[model samples]
Target: MPKSLIASAEWSLLLSRLRALAPEAFDSQGRVLNLVAREWGNPGHGKPYLSPVDGSQLGLLPMIDLSTATHAVASAAAEAEEWARVDLDTRKARVSACLDLLHENHELLALLLTWEIGKPVPQSRVSVERCISGVKWYVENIESMMEGREPLGLISNIASWNYPMSVLMHAALVQALAGNAVIAKSPTDGGLLSLTLAMAFARRCGLPMSLVSGSGGKLSEALVRDPHIACLSFVGGKVNGRDIAASLYDRKKRYMLEMEGVNAYGIWRFSDWNQLAKQLKKGFEYGKQRCTAYPRFVVERGLVPRFLEMYLPMLTSLKVGHPLLGETRAAEPPSVDFGPLINSGKVEELHAMMSEAEAKGAIPLYKGRLEPNLFLPNQDVSAYLGPCAFLHVPRNCRLYHNEPFGPVDSIVVVDTEEELVTEMNVSNGALVASLACDEPETARRIASELRAFKVGINTTRSRGDREESFGGIGQSWQGCFVGGAYLVQAVTEGPPGERLFGNFPDYTLLPEKR
Candidate 1:
């Protein structure tokens, strides 16, 4: 089939699938356009632009062939306006229904996620579950949050590829439940999933089709610059997020950014050495691809010998295979402990970093590699670079100062929490850091002393939790945070608009209830 034809066909298939899965949206003339795929490249030569988890062609529709992304932004902006105008009770009902609709179509959605994003099937399931859970939380708490019912006006949700559906949907629904107009954008990598969910919303709730647009290129730029999109929520790398922040800086946009973190796990103290060993083994389960994955580990001088005594063996025993085979934490065989970096360039960059680290005297515990000419025409496989080595380096080395985003984790020894804090602050990124101490006092001290935006105590960290605000300080973000009532604040609680009715509610009220 011709590439353009295949692109059109993919859109058709997506619409049909969504219609069947969500009859309500279909009945309401709601259709999702998978815009970003069509914007990125041409497709249908059998060799996909993207690679699947099993080394097969990813077989996705290209982004360029789709309709102009500008149309998507306009449509979504329109929907946001209409959604904002709707009564809070009605909006709540629609959001609540969406949660149910999501649950009812979980399996279908999961499959689509795997095909569209190249995540392993098991991880897809978790994403689906997390999305649903996030929806449930919003539904249950939205009313309590909207005490005044003054709309925040505009909220924008920017999502990433790794867990597109869950993160985007969860954040969007929370904003919607709070009665704000939400302008959302899916990354180039997972636009399919984002657009599909938008179709579901339009069909099920009789929502304006414009509410969720999925265009790429200039369209996304337009959406970001739209004066109406007052509050911004973003999830992606620090550089791009920072750019977004710079754009919105003068406008004073309410923003929430879950930017990239070169996260670390401190093995200074552990409640149970054996348990820590087991957990860290599973730590690389997601191929160490997640922003919250532990890419660096700090071991106390005294604990190093004993910790490694148990930790090394546990890591070695991990099953590096297909993601479908229950290895949710790391890439596995057939799958490896991880998939390739998002693209070849990332692979090269990772290799360069490893090489540089090795040259700098960092010792590799498990060296990672990718074959030179693996993308042959009939290989029936995509790219597979197994997890790289876990390197040990001096506390102040360059390797220790960087956040190895992939399956590479570096080890540094510290004699005190003070030293660990100093070393971690060594890098400019302060997104997140972890503590795995056996003693409560050490964990407490580190938690108090640490300069990171978020800290994980005795466990690998993640960004999905709804109550906790997930953004970093310093170089990690542009002052936007997501979680709790922040979503509501971002959209509805901005600076006063045109002076309409009476004076703003009284600030100096009477005595307290207590």
Candidate 2:
């Protein structure tokens, strides 16, 4: 058989299995996309999910309209106090059973997640596994977090497309574990099927975790302003975050807003370029779509050559193609380094950002080309851009301030010590920042100077696990946090404070409940 034919066969087989993960998305005869899932299921609206690699319609999802979404929120709010009254031990047991269901269907969910989001296979699998593990950690350790707290009605989690399961949905599950009724808005671009399946599993296990899906503009007002919604969690770009924050300003609501920032890594008087290079290579695992992705690099004037020499090759060598394609296919296919953006429109946006930066002074280190796709060879590879990186991005450039949420960003070379910190902190607030300094005293100094949520010295950090807290400082974050106890507190009612979690720098100083 030809390679394309083989790939087609594999694609069909895998897609069938993926569809099995969420039977709600299909009809008995496989015609309707009836996908509104709550206590009772109904068909709302059909939206076709386009493939990121080729712009092909992967499947049509039955999404909820505004009325459906409002009802879901109202229902969750009305039932939350009763849910809180349930014995904590019983709640844990129910959630544990749901996690077991998630575990059993892990491979199924992971397969669909990559197809929906354009993440590589290995990376998507790890995301699903880690989501399960992280939620388990919260469930086991949440008793201490509820000390002086009460369940804060309904927590509406609305986040970006990239980390629907691992971050946004992870926080939603933890909210339920913290005794709040949870409702999550599925990312309209991707992850609809996987999230709906996970929520369906939770609902089946007796958890009041409802899910709604639609465009943000249509539902943002309803979800944010709904009287029943006690807290709102918005995670996406800065514009959306700001709009939601503004809406909740006068309202007595618990909220967490995590927006984008220039997550920069500074190189100042560092010797180990090779080690730094490897870490940088691994850092762009998911096309830099992650909230914690270090898309900007601030290198010392003297170290620019060494940094580029070590970093450029890794950036340019990234492979972009269909997630199902590989040299050999077996139990687990050989993973590609880079995959599709959410869709073709995003690819065009990335091009525009690169063009703007280039016109302003940035140099294109690489212009990525798409590889031949065996999986969907006939379809145009519009969403797949191989590996594109830029250097000499001016401080005033839009690319410097706005994060290009794809596999592209720029490097800025700075001369003076003050200039290094100045350029790194130019975004004012960022999710994460790191400085590469082998020397201890200088590393500590540089790390302290960073105005980011998480700072790393000679290493890279991320939205960490159970013990570590995750929140942005300054403009990057605006509300309470997620991760361990902080996440629990954010969803539950409590007194105002400068510190909620352990002394984590990126902790969002939540506003007082009026």
Candidate 3:
């Protein structure tokens, strides 16, 4: 049985805070306010968000057409130009104060995340807190980052909703601190209300940051093709990133794209079973929806038994349920490990992939129980999937090549060092990979062959900490990278139009590391 750490009294107070969340994707001077709902004798002109928690309707957020988006971007560009003229000191103060505002409102934002996307309360709070704190570190250090650089005009960031505050708002805040006005499209799936409040608070603090909510199909072309956007920072799937990359290819606009890939963990000569056991649960946190999740594992044949010994028990120990509910009541103590995926569609997709892998050659290692009892009897449980794992998933299976983007795990068995690296790199390239080998020479040799941006020799890595650079290799990333000083330079330039990254013959970027 799972426990809910939230007391009944606290849950009621949290609900009260969530009810106070009004949608507002604000621009400076409220320029885009009139565009939210045109009121052409119709109130049903937008999409209504369905709560992943209970399949209930949250509220209708109006969708705008391409023309409205164009107007919004142009208005933002004008604001950016004006905002750029403000003294650097004032910009820093306002932006830092904006971080302060978000910190104060994190509880409300966390609740909105739980209600909107079904993220567990603990992880949601951590995302909000980590993002605000990390971005604040950048604000205090931006002057040095901008020492020899000049601000680019308008920065348009289109990001996914998984880590709305940490990734989306994090980039936007740093862009503002760099003297660029930031504009964003609120992710279609979730974070609409949380990011709306973030943008509104930014506007109140005199930062030129704005966000729009609508269908990506309707707004993506305009958001990418618009003339006023000086740079684009995107966080989403590879297909959408490719589309935006195509639009920017001939135009010479700067961008930083963080896309998804099947990050893998390679296990070779290793005997630290207890320590390795401790890391398994953390790797599966948030149902492995994270872009950096190591969902694929390549294990040496000798270590297969040892690996399952740790992984199987870790799977059983994981608890999944409604974010706010316990086994008995809302007030019952202890929280779940995670909640549902973004939607039922994700659950279906994961199940389909798992089936495909099984049909090819994979053997089921573990399949935990789903606790749909935590949900309302009348509510849908399609979004809930328990921890699942497969052994010896063949190279021909779809799960062997692509990221399931859910809690499902695929492990490939290999006999030799060469086969281990081959299985690890079978996905061609990725953002992160991990290696667990007791021998330092084997670890060093294996690490050199893996095609990933960040390699954890004996652990896992993620887009945490302000000092670390975050970007991917191969299809996982496009355009220049973002993080630390590289992030600020994604928009600014040492000299106007000076190139910051080298490109392959086809123009895919080779991110510069200093």
- lDDT tens digits, residue span 240-354, model 3: 8778777787886877777778898999999998888788788777888899988888898888888888888888999888776652264464567878888888888888888
Candidate with better lDDT, 1 vs 3: 3
- What tens digits encode model 2's per-residue C-alpha lDDT throughout 1-514? 1244334334456567655765654566552242233464654577777767556676666576788788778778877878989878888998899889889988767767777888876788799988999999878887887777888878888888897788876887888888888878778898877787788788778887877767788887668888888888888889888888778778877787888888999988898978987898888787788888888888888888888788878776666667756512434443577678888888899888888889987888888776554344476777766667888777677787888888886788888878889989878888889899878888787777788888888889898879787877777888777776778877787765535542223343532210
Q: Residue 105's C-alpha lDDT in candidate 1?
A: 71
Residue lDDT tens for model 1, 65-181? 223444555555555666677887887788777777777777667756655554555667688898888778777787776776566655666677677667776776777677665
- Model 2: runs farther than 4 Å from truth? 1-37, 327-334, 373-376, 495-514
TM accuracy, model 3 = 0.91
TM-score, cand. 1? 0.78
lDDT of each: 0.58, 0.76, 0.76
Clashes of 2: 0
lDDT of 2: 0.76
Clashing pairs in 3: 3-334
Clashing pairs in 2: none
Q: C-alpha displacement of 466 in model 1, angstroms? A: 3.6
TM-score: which is higher, 1 or 2?
2
452 in model 1: Cα distance from truth in Å?
2.0
Which candidate, 1 or 3, has the higher TM-score?
3
